[model samples]
Target: MSALGMQSSILVGGFQYWDSRRKGRQFPARGDLDPLIDIPRLVPHIILIDVRHDPLDFRFRLIGSAVRRNLARDYVGHWFSEFPNYSASSNIWPRHCAVAESGRPMLQRPTYVGPNKDFIYVENILLPLSVDNPGWSMQMMFLEFISKRH
Candidate 1:
């Protein structure tokens, strides 16, 4: 199994507690809740994709503006290959695929290269979203800064 596969398994197993806690609360649909109400509650930079599609064709359906600003562009609807480096795509896509395929979540700390190739550490949560569609197309992601100084 890939490193991401191992991480996905661990995250899924650990999520039992998280799910239970969430169930105890009442979180409405995204449309029903205020967009800015709990930005911190869900880390915003993480990327989610529709696993049923080719990773090269997979689009990010949801993204936070904070993430967009950090990225400096609209990454939603873009392919992972479009990222600055092939290393970034290779490092992230497999783990993303592992979680989506297993209906599990994966925690990843990815480094993004900023201006002048400065690396920024982003802690991310990749959550699988099971929709009724036959293709099983969807995933949710959350991201936060592990170190602002990065």
Candidate 2:
């Protein structure tokens, strides 16, 4: 089983890639990943978030095409706090906070609450990305959608 105990091949693959990049460090630097050259097929489903502190907020550094299509908006360069329906008390925020603070991979299975309710849920792997400094990092998120029954 993968570190996150997930069975989805896509999630597993993403985890494997992130794990491989670690070398010996607890987390890999953002510069370590090149979506086009390394994970081309999974590129469209990836989202990169910039972690900010002194209040703790997240910014959309990069939103993949597939993710944008599903959300029906391109949120690149926007903060998560600016998104509609976003609340600090929301269930999603803590998951992110945990990963950011702990520098660990987290498996998230959140039901579809976006524009399209036809999807049953989404499988997401949030992997922490570190720089040279401590307490400063980004998050690499990989997602897969599951459709609801007819």
Candidate 3:
């Protein structure tokens, strides 16, 4: 069960759309993602992550406008592990690993720790992405960070 207070229909809808694309496969590929240009309201809240491995890294691929503003910074091109959320032994790390390993979606509540240890209560969803010829290099993923703050 999710610890989130109230779910956003937009987030739920986006997950459903991505889930639908799987069609019994491991996960939805990047090519299968919708443009999201159709939903202007959601554009600023969505985030995309790349599930990289070797040491199991999660890279920030896209940091939406609203999230960027809420976070007071953008992390695109940066590694999720650098942040407190994905730090070793953190609740979020294991759940994210589960999603990467099982190729399933996981909804988890994690307190995001920014620089200076500022904590933001957030609900995050993790999804896998793969290509026909699945490999780490092509293993993209999705993550939605819905902050309860602000």
Best model per TM-score: 2
For all predictions, the C-alpha RMSD in Å is 6.9, 2.0, 4.3
List, residue by residue over 1-150, the lDDT tens digit for candidate 3. Answer: 144332756556556666677888867677776646544566676777776677778777886676676564678998767977556567766776777788767665656654424445565555677755444523332234544444
Quick one: ranking by lDDT, best first? 2, 3, 1
Q: What range of 10 consecutive residues in model 3 has the weakest lDDT sum?
A: 137-146
Tens-place lDDT per residue, model 1, 43-104, is 34445565455423356666875466666566677766667443245666677667656756
Better of 1 and 3 by TM-score: 3
Clashing pairs in 1: 43-143
Instruction: State each candidate's clash count.
Output: 1, 0, 0
lDDT of each: 0.52, 0.83, 0.62
For residue 39, what is the lDDT in candidate 2?
A: 87
For each candidate in turn, the TM-score is 0.61, 0.90, 0.72
Local error of candidate 2 at 16, Å?
Answer: 0.7
Off by over 4 Å in 1: 1-48, 53-57, 81-89, 115-119, 148-150
Say which candidate scores most in lDDT. Answer: 2
lDDT of 2 by residue, 42-122 (tens): 888899998887578888888777778888577899887886554467888888899988988999888877787788888
Itemize residue pairs with steric clashes in candidate 3.
Answer: none
